[model samples]
Target: MNRMNWYVVYTKPKWEKKVAEKLNEIGIECYCPIITQIKQWSDRKKKVEIPLFNSYVFVKLPDMDRNSVFQVSGVVRYLFWLGKAAIVRNEEITAIKENLSNTNISDVCILPYKKGDKIKLETGVFSSQDAVVQEVTNTHYILVLESLGCLLKIKYKKDTL
Candidate 1:
């Protein structure tokens, strides 16, 4: 039997929790990458945890039995590249664990953001709109927008936008 390495699984939109629960119940080794986010809503604002990527999840499985692993619900497929099982580098996995680690995590927690990426706030009045992250702070973020020739800086809760 081929030894298992980590493989990426594509899950349906917003089905990560269900997939994870089913996998764990069946004793499958699976991982869902998540991060804490600053959430904003109409009534109130709060910090909430959410998945970094919406439709992608990871599973530790051997290449040969990939078919058997695919039978899980909400699991679309295992990622492949060059006709072989694509490997998620150890550092990538480590980065995830390090982000999720509660011990000493406060010092390390960040938005997992990249420069020049469009993000939508999943909740709040700003939800469903595209905004550029100007700067990130512990509990809030400096959001920016360009309308014609003006720069707007608004302090938005970390998870809001």
Candidate 2:
């Protein structure tokens, strides 16, 4: 295993749980971060469980062979570099634990924002640049500027990015 208890597997968009379940059914360990999302319908609304990051799922395998894991159903690929499998950091799992255990998952938190406003890039590559808000409705905001001319989306939190 060699410090590779956790590895990343790129999966079909919105198929995170299916892959995790498939892997688990065959005795392979896996973890898919589940988050709560409220779905609205004309007739009814409900809170549905969803994966936090789309197209990403985690697996625990005894080896770092990329092909072995990639062959699994719904798996597009494994995170790798220079033809070698990359290990997922332990902290990533820890962060997920905190989010699930410490926060109120039923209530989806919204970041205060709206479309078409002047914004300042506080961090990342475009930091210190003035940007125009293209879309802001919840926890994420999309920014744009002619100088960069590319969409810059960011997640917001008052105390942390």
Off by over 4 Å in 2: 64-66, 81-84, 105-161
- Leading candidate by lDDT: 2
What are the per-residue Cα lDDT tens digits for candidate 1 across 61-130? 7777667656678988766655755676554466456435533333223233334545775764345545
- Tens digit of per-residue lDDT, candidate 2, span 38-143: 7999999998898765676777766744456555689998766446665655554554555455433333232333346677768744455566767765565555
RMSD each, Å: 11.5, 8.9
Q: lDDT value for candidate 1?
A: 0.58
TM-scores, in order shown?
A: 0.59, 0.58
What is the TM-score of candidate 1? 0.59
Error of 2 at 34 (Å): 0.6
Model 1: lDDT of residue 99: 36
Candidate 1: regions farther than 4 A off: 102-161
